[model samples]
Target chain A: MTTTLSLEQEVARLIVEALHLETAPEDIDPEAPLFGDGLGLDSIDALEIALAVSKRYGFQLRSDDERNHRIFASLRALAAHIETHRTA
Target chain B: MPAEPAFPLTARAPGEVLFRRGAEPVTTARFLAEAAGLAARLPAEGPVLNVCADRYLALLGFAAALMRGQVTLLSADRTPQRLAEIAARHGARCALSDTPASLPLPVIAPAAEAGPEAPNPAIPAARIAAIGFTSGSTGEPQPHAKPWGALVAGARAAAARFAVAPGTSIVGTIPAQHMYGFETTLMLPLHGGGAGHAGPVFYPSDIEAALAAVPAPRLLVTTPLQMRALLGTGIALPPLIGVISATAPLDAALAAEAEAAWGAPVREIYGATEAGSIASRHTTREEGWEPYPGVAFTIGEEGASVTVPGLPAPVPLADRLEWCGQGRFRLAGRLTDMVKLAGKRASIAGLTRILTAIEGVEDGVFLAPPDLDRNPRARLAAAVVAPGMDAKAVLAALRERVEPAFLPRPVVMLDALPRDAVGKISRAAIAALAWKR
Candidate 1:
């Protein structure tokens, strides 16, 4: 699989692991919302997700990041985040 | 490691004040000599409770406990019931308290003994050196046993991580009897070439005044809850070499502000009663929690299982972690804190950690409404102590930094956050208070 697709799958797995999504990884749409009604992620989940990504990718997840809400907006956005920054 | 004799301790420096506060301070060499004197005089058998009100004497008892092969039992609220529980658990026949006359067990003033001082040889470790009670928010109080070698190792590790400059006097706001307080304030100061303040520090003003009592290059050891209070009060303190915060999460922003206010590096030590402090973070926003040079980490489900460079195997963690490389990792809160909301996973501990870090907040706690499922919009209710700022103000500050979903709804204003002995606030307690509103 391409890095983009792989990253997308990894994000799905992480969302499932972090928030314990009931659905399969493939069931998650990249463009669907993660924080709002789409996947229902909250702040605590955001921290867990952010820290997990930082540890796996090697850099802090800055709270001041302007595109934070958008980056964490969906599986696809998160996957793209991982794609641009995966040290591991 | 029993007294192997190969690595015998030196004839430690005399008058090297082990701890000093008020008008007097203790020298390590003097303290060690006194402990040796106490060792020479203490009965060969039966446990002696130590409650020397004078921090110096209590510190002497601590060193004496190590040297004499006696077990020191500690509890901050050493009420009659707790004392009785402690004495019975250790089969103690005598108790050392500030007031010797009132103790249930036989008590003695532990007269200051004098002798030509000499550094004690490495004795057989433990044989059970110290005992303390758990936070006990769970079940019947559990006892945590501290071995001598482990105590020595923990003290040395903390000193090395903190790098107390010479002549540094360590002062404390927490009781010296509690494990966290005992290990850092009482023990670390001695081993790392410093002294402990004699008087007890109660309020933030008390801490400020006590800081003045101790000599320069001072280390003020406290908790996140207390640090928040200092930031709120905006007190000008003495020249603090470093600040050691433990027993609770020190929010990054609050920590940074404290560092700014005191003009000293605020070092947060990650530790617990079960395991002594093992790691240090110089900055709140610092990404990695560095293990004391000799401490090691191996990440797993229960968090990071740690093995000090020479420790046998590795011990597991009760908290979560973001295991980074290069002998450092980010620490999340306790595992028990991970919560489930309508089958959605989140961490109440993490939420609370973030809450207290918000500017102007003294102490903050986040609780999931018991009827969370019933009230979808209920979100999370919080009880906060923000003295100068109101709930909306705190919410606005949090909104400026964090996401909208995490904004604490219906923030309950409290004079102070409720915490048990170990300074932990339970979600159940939070919910119970929210119900009142």
Candidate 2:
């Protein structure tokens, strides 16, 4: 059977592709945040990549989402949120 | 006036080439040679259209045409249709184009090749150089004619503010056809103290490369969106004496981010479609901009209004502002950029920022339809990327931060927004998006 990737692996792939980030997916740590100190993604990039995720993954993130902190916490968390939802 | 500033005096003599992307740096004699070439080629009486891809060349063409006593029509949008329209409007018989691959429009190339040559060319000031088009934020782009003397005066005022010196390399990433870019990169090099890169730079990486290619004490003239994108890239940039950002609002947060990321203060210029440029802000420390020296102004004007040279027509600014001493004022958001909700009011710009701040929201924008004027409530629509989240959830969050009335109703989720050439969301586009209900 074809192997299914973990949430972390999937999210890492998404980040690399969405941002054109010059890094290998495996290089991304599951514990690191996607913005600020971790990946240093700015607000604009956040919006751009978020849109990408919505179109490709069929999931939307709302502004002022109380869970924003956790949702953006790390690759693991984002992957988890996506795995739990993702329509497209 | 003051003995016309002599050209080809490279403080960094024999060092760098005059133009980079697609222009030639020639001695004063060379600039005139190219001008003379065009003059010889043209039928002395008709207006000339300048489609020089290289911004520097366009400036030179403008000057050369003026000296040869020809009227120059400058159009920023060089699409075939627009070019044809401009050519017809001005009865231009020929055009100067840097792009060899461009259409056959009797295009002429500059005689000077791109490079560094030791030659001082004396150019007479006071010639009527060229015409420039406004950004068309308010409506259709209007043309503003400038005399050589006027351009020189404007550049002198700008140079004094920037404090650039001879041989100080200034690189531009913005299209030179625009007034702000023309003044900073082309005119500044000719009449003021610095040397400018030969071409227009458009990309973030190009901006970085331009900064490195130009020697120390360099200046970068760019728009706010480009500035934001450059910062987002998180690339290392060379030491910039200053970064000139215009063509849009330089929000305090964005400016602070730029300063923090680049370790250089981003100086903002207040300019528009009508006026070339009149005031500038060195730091966010002072709320408003200090006017370019020798320019004066007051607040209110209805129509047929006149203000200082290099300033927009004397229309009451769309936004309120706090004035500093003469020629300086802090811009509050535009008055028209605001909207009212049920017993509450907020700036659309503010809502856009809040929406953009959402996690996993790529390229989200809040927009209100023009028909909302019939019932100007806080009714809003938005194109968003938060795929998993529904419109109700989006509204719920907006309510938490902003007033409930200001919460967007009937949020329209779309794949993307229609941003224009400069990444600006036009009112028409917004209204069009709001077409359905």
Candidate 3:
């Protein structure tokens, strides 16, 4: 559980750094939505995050993949996906 | 009077494929049949607000409206407020949408089921085929009328410029409602003797899938933003004949990289909603734009204005141009304070108006990043003098008023706006404040 929490924190930092979000990484709710109503991020922000994630985790996030809706649902979901798929 | 020329200037054999709907090829015969069927069901009287997310359905709606002598209103801004305003302004009787929408008028989804082939009918050259709306400086959506003949001429010119030959498959990332998308993806194929892919290609994967779905020789109609994301994905794309980019200025470095990766020439189109596509350039090879055939430019003290063959009068351009002689010119700078991001256009002044209109917002200004055109991640920034209001509240308010693409990020709170002796705050001041935050 601690390891998962750290991964989520690392991802939160990455998101803030990549997207230049004004929100602090520690303030981001891990289970809250990252798009639309939650973080107010849009498609452009998604592309930026994907590029950052690819560089950090060494895997591509294809935009049209059906799993994207689940993978990008929240900070926790994205962090979990990275934990399973990260090679770097 | 002499009969008007047919709507599609260039005609292909009935059996030839006109569009690829997903993986299935839709022949010209079938498309005409579906359009005719849709047209038969449309109300016989007023203009139509076409909000179809599917390119093929939008084309069908457009064709049906043209056949019925009803002008089709095209707007990329499909927000309920904007759609309602457009419908009310144009007295639109109905809206044709593929997906469910809470629109003001009656919504009709044109049946995609194939019907019996129908004969092609001639539409009047003078008939207003479409009215494209762009955000005016005053915040109202300005309407630009496009006649069927003009649209046909514009498409033919673009086809010749890009060498979009018969059997070429065109796929686009931009939505079909915008003027550039309509001209390149929809109109170009109808008149260019090429087949189009009915795509809502937003993401990199979608672009790759759509391109792979259609047969080569493929032509990618996209903006610089999508091109950057697609290239970043490092995904192998199908062999493309060529690439055509527009809406925002394409960076020469990015264009060169795209050319190197795809082994295809990257061409940039210079046009506007007011005049459609007027010029093209091989981005890696040329610094100046070559105007399309029958497109003449006049560079005067005021700015540049282009005279196209089919439009009734010369349309003034908002871009300052340096004439290179023989109908060629270089884009010097933009005359208006318009900012384009992710293929969406919004004037800074208009955005500022919305920012200040919020109660408790004493003063504010919206700042477009200096590198917005070249930087894919560049976003609009704002500095608000809203006491007791947080950035989240300001952003939430803005999200309601503007499209997601135009929402200001990092809304900086300021005690007071920095104004000069004349009581005018320069853009540099706001940009600096937002940058500091």
Candidate 4:
């Protein structure tokens, strides 16, 4: 549980840093959406996050991967996907 | 009377594949049959609001509208307010959508199956096939009507300029509803005799997969923003015959990089919704834009107005152009307050209006700082003076009013905006306030 929480926090920080969000990483709700209504991120931000995740986790997040809707749904989901797919 | 030129200016074999939807090849016969079937069910009168998410469905809706002699309104903005405004303005009777959602107008999902035989209807050249809307400076959408003949002519000109041969698969990263995407991806395949990849290809990996799904001699129709993202990923792409970019200016270095990396020439189209592709340039080799065949640019004391072959009158150009020799010209600068980001355009003044309209927003200003690197991901920033409201609240209000692309990020909260004696916030001042944080 601690490891999962830490990974989610790490992803939150990565997203904040990559997207240059005004809010602090800790302020981001783990369950809230990373796009549209929540953090107001758009498709470009999604690409930016994908690139950042690939660089950090050594895995590619393809938009048409079918799991992308779940992976990018929130910080927790993204962190979990990274946990499973990260080669590094 | 002179005989009216029919649509689909180029002849295509009935068995030739015109579009690739997922793994399925949609032949010319299948496309025409589907369009005819959809056309039979369309409203008898008034224009149609086509908001189909799928590229293939959007094209079918467009062709169906064209067959019925009804103008199709193409807009990427699907907000209820925007749709309502369009419906009110054009008296749109129904909307053609693939997604299951409610809209201001009656929604019609185009699921028309292909019939046994294709219908080769003779569509008049003078028919207003589509009306593309651009976000006006006054916060209203300005409609630019495109005739079928003009679209066909523009597509053929582009095909010739880019050397796009028949059966070449065209993959696009931009939406089919945008003017550039519509012309390059959708219209190009129809009139240019190329096949279009008919799924949403946004992310870099998706673009690669879509390209891999298509056949050889592929042409990529995309904007500089998407191109930048695609290149940034460093993802391996299938061999491309050529790449055509528009909506935003393509930097020479990036163009050269793409040409070198992909081993294909990078071409850019200079056009607007008002005039569907007017000129083309081999970005890596040429600095000046050469007008397409039969298109003439007259530079008068007022400004430059382009005379497209099929348009009724000359349309004034919004960009200041410096004429070289022959039919080539260089873009000087934009003459409007419009800022384009990721192929979506919005006026700064209009954005400011939306910003201030929000309750508890005392004063605000939006600025798109000139990105020296021309980064496709560059976004609009804002500084607002809202006493009791937080940035999230302000943004939430803004989200309802503007498109996601135009939403100003980092809504800076200020005690007061720096205004001069005349109560005007200069561009320099806005830039400083917006970017300083």
lDDT score at residue B85, model 3, on the 0-100 scale: 95
Interface RMSD to the true structure, each candidate: 16.0, 17.6, 3.2, 2.7
Docking class of 3: acceptable
When candidate 2 is compared with the true two-chain complex, its DockQ is 0.04
Q: Candidate 1 recovers what fraction of true contacts? A: 0.02
- List, residue by residue over B63-155, the lDDT tens digit for candidate 2: 566656777877765446556756766667788776652444576775544333224334344444577753233223356776555566677
Evaluated against the true structure, the overall lDDT of model 4 is: 0.82
Best by DockQ: 4
lDDT of each: 0.65, 0.61, 0.84, 0.82
Candidate 1, superposed: residue stretches over 4 Å from native: A1-88, B1-11, B100-103, B111-121, B135-138, B309-313, B337-437
What would the per-residue lDDT of candidate 3 be over residues B1-437, giving only the tens digit for each residue?
Answer: 96666565236678988888988998888888898899999998869999887888988999888778899999987668889999999999999988767887899987776778787777777778999988876678899999888998998898888888888999987778899999988898788768888876776777888898888899999888778877887878999999999988889999999999999999999888889999999999998999999998988988889998678999998788997765579988777788876666679899999999998899998888877756756889998999989888898788777777778877788898888779888778878877765
Better-scoring candidate (DockQ), 1 or 3: 3
**Per-residue lDDT over B1-437 for candidate 1, one digit per residue giving the tens place of the 0 to 100 score:** 65442212322365566667474765656666777776666566656677665666776666666666677877654445556767777788666655534656777566556667757556554355677665332223466677666666777777777787657888876667767788777767655556778765644556777888877888888876566655554567888888988765566777888988988888877765566677888765576888876777777775677775323346666667887776688866555644433212245666777778877888887776654433322356778999998765776566543334445656778887777778776656666777764
Per-model TM against the reference: 0.62, 0.59, 0.91, 0.92
Fraction of true contacts retained by every candidate, in order, equals 0.02, 0.00, 0.27, 0.39
Ranking by TM-score: 4, 3, 1, 2
Residues B302-412 of candidate 4 have per-residue lDDT tens digits of 778999978999998877788887669998776667787656678889999989988899999888777822666778888899999998889889877787777876678
Best by lDDT: 3
Q: How large an RMSD does model 2 have?
A: 14.0
Better of 2 and 4 by DockQ: 4
Query: Model 2, range A1-88, lDDT digits (tens) per residue?
Result: 1112565677788777765554579977778876544654543344455655666676555433122456778877777777777786
lDDT of 4 at B392: 80
Report the number of the highest-TM-score candidate.
Answer: 4
Q: lDDT, candidate 4, residue B406?
A: 77
Candidate 1 achieves a global lDDT of 0.65
